[model samples]
Target chain A: MVLLACGTAMAQLPIYNVGRAPTEAELHPSDGVVGSDGKELPPGRGTAKEGETIYAAKCAACHGKNGEGIYPWPRLVGGIGTLNTPIPVQTVGSYSPYATTIWDYIQRAMPPFPLEKNLTPDNIYALTALLLYWNGIIKEIDVMDKNSLPEVQMPNRHGFYPDPPQSTPNKDGTWQPYWNQAKPAAK
Target chain B: MNSKMSDRRGFLKGTAAMAGLAVGAIPFANGNALASVTPGEPNTSMGVTKLGVTPDEPNIQDLLYGGRSRYETTVRIPSVGWNGATGLRNLTPLQDSIGVITPSSYHYLVQHDMHITNIDPRQHTLMIYGMVDRPLVFTMEELKRLPSVSRIHFLECTGNSGLMHYKSMLHDQKLGRADLTVIQAMHGRVSTSEWTGVPLSLLLKGAGVQKQASWLVAEGADLCRHAKSFPLAKAMDDVIVAYGQNGEALRREQGYPLRLVVPGWQGVNNVKYVKRIKLVDKPYYLGRETSSYTNLKPNGKASWYESQVGPKSLITYPSDAHHLPERGLYEISGLAWSGRGAISRVEVSTDGGRTWKDAQLQQPVFRKAFTRFRLGWNWSGAETVIMSRCTNEYGDIQPTMLELAKLWGDQVTPHYTGEEIEHWWETAAIMEFLNNPILPWRVKPDGSVQDALYNTLYNTNGPSKNSYYSGGKI
Candidate 1:
C-alpha cells in the first residue's frame, strides 16, 4: 500500500491548518485603519510635481523611474486588464481605485522597507497626484489638493461599488442572509 | 524523510544540538517521556497537538519549509548569536491518506518581524479580568493545573501570503510567502501539538463570566504586545489556555509559559505572551489590528477587526523561485483550511488560467485544521502557471487577490490572505528595464529578512513618509 501510494501527492502531506475552531484569540491584533469616508486616506496630501519628488525619493528605488516595478517587487504601473490572463499583473493606473487609496497605501505600508515611519500629508497627497498624472488620471500640470483629490476619478472606479451590508434587512424583511442564501433552495 | 516517532521526539529537542555538520541542533521532543497528548484518542503513530497555544510558540517546524536544500544550510532555528545558520521549517500536515494526528515538529509557521532568541518565560504571566466575578492571573504552571482538554485544530493567519498574487487565486503563489526563518516560520512558528491546557470555558466558569460579556481582550508580552479581542462564544467553544505544545513546554518564540489558543480562527486571534485577558463588550482597534496586518485596499478603506479567516490553499514543494523538472508524476503538496468550516474540496490548475484538475485530499479532513492536499501530475516542462482553489464547508470560495482586493480595501493584501496562484515554469523571469526598481528585501540564511533593500534603491514610497497624528494626543 505504501509503495502503491508513493507517487500520490496527497500522501506526502506534512502540515495543515485546522478548521475555524474557537481558540484563544489575541487581545491586540493589528488595528488596521479605514477612513470613516471609506478612506485608508492618510493624514496627508501632495501635488503631481511634489509627488514626483516624494516618489523618486521614496518609491523610485524599488518601483524604478517609470513605476515599472522590478524583480519580485512588481511594476506599479499598467497591466489594468491583465486579470485572469497570462499577462503579468501590475498596479496603480491599470488597477487600483481612489487617489485616497494611493496616499493611504503609502501612508500605511509602501516603500517596502525602512519600516513604518509614515509619510507627510503633503507628500502623500503629492505622490497620489504624481501616480495619477503618470497613469494619465490627472494632467502633469494639474494641482492636486483635497477637493480636487476626491474628484480626480480613477479608471477602475467602475470596478467597485459599496459592498452590500453583510447583515441587512431583506426587501420583505425576510432577511435571507448570504449564509442562508443558497441553503434550503436545494430542498 | 524521517520516521514519525522521531519527528515527535525531535519536537521535544527542537533546541538540541545535533551532529555538528549543518544546523547540528537535533530537536529533542523525545525527552518528555510521560507527557500524554491532550486526551482525544491518540490518532496516529506520531502525535502532535494542534492549535492550543500562543502564536509565537516555536515547536516542531510545521507549515511549509523551503531553502536549506544544502547540508551546510540544514535549517535550524536561528537566534541572533547563532553563527548565521539556517533553521528548520516544516510543512503543513495535509494528506489524510496518512493518519489523524500531526507529528510534533512538522506543522507550519509564518513568523513576523522574525523574533529570534527567547522571550523570558519566567517573567511571563497570564492575567484575565473585565466582566468577571474575579479577575484572574495565572503563571504557566497555574494554567497547566486547570483540567486539561486537548483537541485538534488549525490557526490560520488572515494575511498569510496575501502578498503573492496570480490568476485564479489559488495554488498560483509559491511556497508559504513569509519567513524562511524557523523560530517563526514552520518548526518555530505554527505547529500541531497535543496541547494539554485549560479549556477557556472552565476559566470563564471560574471567573463567573458575566451574562452581558461580549468580547475577551487577550494581550501578549511581545515588544509589540500583540493583542486582540475574541468573541465570548468562541472562547468557551474551542479556545485553550495552552501551557504545553507538541507534548512539551511551549517554546519561547511560541509563547512559552502561557498563551491564548483559539482554533479554527485567524492566527492573529491567538495572543502570545498572554499577560492579560480582559473581557470587554466591544472590539478595540489595537495597533496590530488597525495598522499592521489587516487588509487594506487601493480605495480608502481598511478591514479592521476581521476575525474570520477565509479559505485558502497553497502548493508547498515547488513554490516560489523553484525549477520544475520535466514533470512526470511530480507530487504536488500543500495546505488547505477554512474559517467557517471544513475544506470540502481543493481544485488544482496547471496551465496558467486554462484547466483545472481535482487534487486528492488526505483523510480525516477535520474542521478548522490544516488539510493536506496532494496530486500527481506530468509537467510538460513548459512555462505554465499552477494554482489551487480551496472551497470550505460553507462553500465560501477563496477569492483571488485581485477579486478580494476589489472587495476588501485600504489595508488589503499584496500577499497575506489573498488567494491566487501564479505558477510559471520554463524559466520565465521578471521583466527587466533600465535601472528597474521594486527590489525586494533579501532574506538572510540566518532567519534575518532585510525589507526592500532593492526596493529602497528604487521606491521610497513607504508609510514613514506620512503624517503622524499621535495615536491620541499621547
Candidate 2:
C-alpha cells in the first residue's frame, strides 16, 4: 500500500490539500489524555483529606460515601486479591494497573455526564488520592500531584500480560485454530 | 440493459396480476380486503376481523422521510442501570433481524458512561498528531473531499453474550435447566453495517506518520474522551474513519458525524465520535483497556489487547422464545461471522452435536461481515436440541461450551463432585469475556424452544437434585 501511494507521486495523486495544521490552542485540550507514563499529567496538588470533602458534595450520591459503589456505579476500593477468586469484585484498587489511570478516568469520565466537566485538575488528583487511600494504597495526608501520582504503584501493576500473537494465515489464506496456539504468557 | 429492464417490467406485471387475483377473491367493491369485514365477527376461520379502511395517502411531511410500517414493532433494547452510571448499551433485535445489514436506527450502541454526543458536522474536526511529522486537522467537509471507500462489516461488543455465559453456568449448576433468555438478550450486542469513510492509512500518510510509531491512540469527543490503542499495522490494513453508515449519515447514537471503523476488532477499539488519532511508539495503556476490556483468567492473570473476536454463529430462528408450531418441516436459519475473515462454512446439528449437516450459505458473503445460513429441519414434536456452528476463512471453528471450558482450564464431566462444581463455577464467571461457545436450543414436546448450554448434562440426566423447578417436579 505504501509503495503504491508513493509510486503515484503525492502531488500528482488525487490527494486533496484539505487538511491544515492545527493551532496550539486547538491541540491543547485534545492532548490531555494521561498515558501510563504520566507524561501529560497536569500541574496540580491535592490530598485524600481534601478529596473527602469534594467526594461528599459531588461523587457521594452516585459512588456512595466510601466508594463501595451504588447500584450501577462501580466501587472504587477493595477487591485487591479477588482476580483469582470465584466472585471477583474488580474494583478500581484491585484491577487497575496504573495509578495514573485513576486520574485519567476520573478526570475524563467520572460522576457521569452533564456534571463531568465540573472537576478541576486538583479535584481529580484529590479524588484519585482518596480512592487510593480507601483502597489502603496511600495515606490520607499524602499529597497527590503530577510527580507523586506516577510513583504510586498499584498492587495489580504486574497482573496483566499482553495477548499472545494470533496464528498467521497459511499461504493459501486458511488460518490455524486460535485455541490450538499456546496460552498468553505474562510480560 | 434492455433485457434487465424488460425482466423488471415482467416481474412488476406478475406482481400486479397476483394483486388482481387477491382483489377478485375478496368480496369488496373497492378491492379493499378489510372493507366488507365486520368487527367481532369471525368471517374467516383464522380469527375475528375488525372493520378497517385502507389508510389515506401520506402527505408531503410523511413522505419526506420513510417510516417502517405501523405493524412492524422491532426495537433495540437499552440497558440503563439505576443511575445510568454503568454506561448505556443498546442491543439490536437480532431475533427479528433479517439479512446482514442492520438498520441504522436499530444498530447496537455502546456509549461509555456518556450520552449521545450531539456533534454538528460543520464544526467537528478530527486531529491527527503525535509521533508524526505534520500534525494535521481535517474538518468534516475536508474529510469528505478526500478519497473514500465503503465496505460492509460487523461490529460486536467484546462483552456480547458475556452475561449469558455467567447466567447459563450458574443456572446449569443450581437449576439444571436450560437458559430461558432469548437470543436478542444474549447476542444482540453485534450488528452489521455498510460503512463509508476515508481510510486511516490515507490520513496517516497525509500527516506523515513517523517510522518509530507502532501504535495509535484513537480518542472520542464524548465527555469521557473514551480512547483505545490500535496496532499501526491494523490501522494501515482496513481501519476507516467512517462518516456514513448504511448509505446515509450515521445515526446520532452511532457516533453521528464521525467514528472509527476498525474492521474485525472488538467494538470498543472502534472508538465512537472519534476526534483524535495520536501516533505512539507503544500502546498507551488507556483506562478502558487496562481496567475494563482486559479479560481475567483462572490463573489470576488478565489478558490485554485481545481484540479480535473468534468465529461464532447463532440460530436466530427456532431459538429461545420461538415456538415450533406443530413441528413439521421448519427452516432453521441464523447468522455467522468471524473477525479474522469471511465465514467459509456453517454446519447445523438437529439432534444436538451427535450429527451435523452443512447449511446453505446465502450469496454475496462479505468478509468480516454477517453471513446468513439456512437448513431445513424436520421436528418430530419430541424433545431435541438444535444448534449451528461456523468456521471462518481462517479455519477457526466455533467451540462448544465444553471445548471452551477446557480451553479456560476447567474440565467438564458427566458428573461433577462438590469441589469440581465450585471450580467450574469460578471458571465460568471468569470466562465471561469473549465467549463464543456454540449455544444449543432445546425444542420440547410442547413446541417451546429454549436455550440449552451445550456442555451441560441438563438434557440427558434430566433436572439434577439441585433443580430450581418451583413445583418440586420436572
Candidate 3:
C-alpha cells in the first residue's frame, strides 16, 4: 500500500587517482565456459542410429515430428520429471548437461541463423546421438564414433554445482549477475 | 534397420565428402554482401566502432577489438534451432557491441539454453522472500542502489504458435506465422530502455507486508529454476526492481545485475535467475503453472493458473517474410501490448475480417510498454488478411484461442485475454483433431462443430468465489 521506490557497487580503484570506476569485470563479464575436467572437448561419437538420420533432415524444420515442440520450436522428448512442477516441460534427458556439453552445443550454434546449413561434425555427432537416444540415452541403434564418443554418459550430470566458482571469489572477483531481461521483480 | 540405413547412407556420404573437401573456402549462404553493392558504395567495411554511431567511443580501448576478442571467445549454439527441442536459444555475434544499453556484440539471445554457452555473471543471486515485511538481500551493487524506471516493453514468445500448429487451425497462417523470426519476431526477447530499478513497491516497502500475503514467488537462474507467482495486487501495482536495461548494465543474456520486470506480465511472469521469493497464500501446481502452461481438452479436465498476456496484435511492417514494395499508401506498422491495461484501440484487418479501420497511434502512447500501431494500406496486391485488433483500458477484447476455448471448457491453458483476438494465434482448429469428448453437457448452445469445438464455458479467475473472496478494498 506504499511506494517511494529506490535501487550498484563496482569498485576497483587506483589510476594515480584521476577518474576510474570501471571494473566489475569491466561492468559485467561473468560469461560461461565449464572445463578443467571436461577438457579439450571435441573429438566425437554418436548413435540413436546416427540420431534418426540426424533428426530426419535437419530437425524436421523447427523441432516437430516427435520431439513435439511447435510454437517457437523446442521439444525433443516427453519432459521427464517436470523440474519441480508448476507447468515445466523442458525436454531431452529432461534438462541437459555434458554429453560433451551437448556435443559442444550442437557443433557451435544450431540451424536457424541465416540458416546454419545442416551442421556436420557428423551432424553434431548424430544430433548428440539422437538426443541421447531420445532421452533414454543409447539404443535405437547406438553407434557414435570418435573413440566411442567420450564414453557416453549423461543424466543431467548430477544437476550441476559450480554456480559461482572462480575459486570462491566475489566483490567483483569474477562477476556474477546474469539471467537477463531484468528478472527480480516481486519483493 | 534396413542395413543400418544402408551403412548410414554410406557414412553420411563419406562425411559429406570429407567435409566438402574441408571447408573449401567459406561462403555458404550469401558469403559476402552489401546486397551485391550499388546502394551508393561505402559499399561495405564500415565495421569497427559504435555506441550511437558516427563516433561516441567512451573508450574500452576504443570499444573492444582484435577481430573483436576472437568473436568474443567463441560460443555459437544455432543449427536450425527449436532444433535442440525448444525453450529459447539464439545469441551469436562473437565480439561485443558496447552500450546504448544493449550491444554485448548484438545481444540476440533467447535462452532456455539450447545448449547455452557462456553466461557467468559473478555467482548470480536473486531471492526476495514472500508476503513481505523484512527479507532483504541485494548485491548486484545493492541492485543498483534501488529506484529506477524505464519502459519500451515487448517480450513476445508465448511460444509463438510452435511451427504453425501444423499449418492452421487458423490453419497454419503460413505455419501460424512460421515460428516467427524477424530476429525471433522483432528482436529476440525484446528490449527498449531506461530501466533503472528498486520498486517492487520499494522492495515491498523495504521488506514488511505480512497481512497473509497474496502470492508472490519469482525464481529462475536457468537449468529450469524457472519459477512464477504473483498478485500482491500485481506486486503493489506496476512492479519493477529491474537493475538497469536501456541506460546500461544487466545483459548477461538479459537478466544481469538483477532481473524481474512484470510490466503487464508473461515471459512466465517475468522470472529468471531470481534465486527465490516465497510468500504463498495459494496456487503452485508448479512445472510451469501446472502441466506445461495448461490447455488440454477433448475433456479430461485441466486448465490451471493461466497467467496474463491478453490484448494481442502483431503485423510488423508486413511481416510474414516481407516483400510488399507495391500496395501504395502502405505504412501498416505493428506492435501492441496489454497484459490488461493501456492499448484502447487498434483494428485494421485489410479486407479479411470484412472492414475495420482506425490505425495511427505513435506519439507517446505508453502504459504496459510497446505501443506503436501504424497502418495505411491500399495494396491492390490481392491476397489480403493483413490483421491487428487490440483494445484494452479494461474493456477487454482479444479472445478467440476459438473464443477462449469456448469460454473455458477445453480447459484453456494459454491463459488471459481482452478478446478482439486477431493473429497472436487463434485459428483454434485447422484439422487433425477429433479426439472429442470435451463434453460440458455436450457443447451445443445454438452454434455447431460441437459448439465450435468444445467451448462449454469455465471462466474462473474471478467473478465467483464471492468475487474472488471479500473482493473488496485491501
Q: What is the lDDT of residue A142 in candidate 2?
A: 97
What is candidate 3's TM-score against the reference?
0.25
User: Which is the leading candidate under lDDT?
Assistant: 2
Instruction: Kindly report which residue stretches of model 2 are placed more than 4 angstroms away from their true locations once superposed.
Output: A1-14, A163-187, B1-53, B57-60, B80-85, B164-181, B411-431, B454-474
lDDT of 3 by residue, B1-474 (tens): 244332332232222222122322222243221111111122124564232123323446635642342112222223132222354554322111111223343444456544332335555544455445445455555555444666655443343323222122232224332322232222233333445576677655555568877666666555534555555666676667676676666666666656677775555566645645655564333334432443333332333343455565554444432333233445556666665557778766664344557787776766665677776666665554445566666555543343333444433333222231232122221111111111111111121111111111223443223111110101
Per-residue accuracy of model 1 over B364-470 as CA lDDT, tens digit each: 88777668777876665444445566777767665543233234432222322212223221001111101100112222333222322222212334323311101
Docking class of 2: acceptable
Question: Model 1, range A78-174, lDDT digits (tens) per residue?
Answer: 6555532443343666545555555545544455333534566676677778878877778877876656676767665544322321122234322
Candidate 2 residue lDDT tens string, B92-199: 777766788889878888887647688999989999988887788888998998889999999998778764333443443365333224575567789999999999
10 residues in a row with least lDDT, candidate 1 chain B: B430-439
Q: Could you tell me how far off, in angstroms, the CA of residue B42 lies in candidate 1 after the best superposition?
A: 38
Best by DockQ: 2
Q: Candidate 3 lDDT (Cα, whole model)?
A: 0.44
User: Sort by lDDT, best first: what order?
Assistant: 2, 1, 3
Instruction: Looking at model 3 chain A, report the run of 10 residues with the lowest lDDT sum.
Output: A178-187
Local distance difference test, each candidate? 0.47, 0.71, 0.44
Worst 10 residues of 3 chain B by lDDT: B434-443
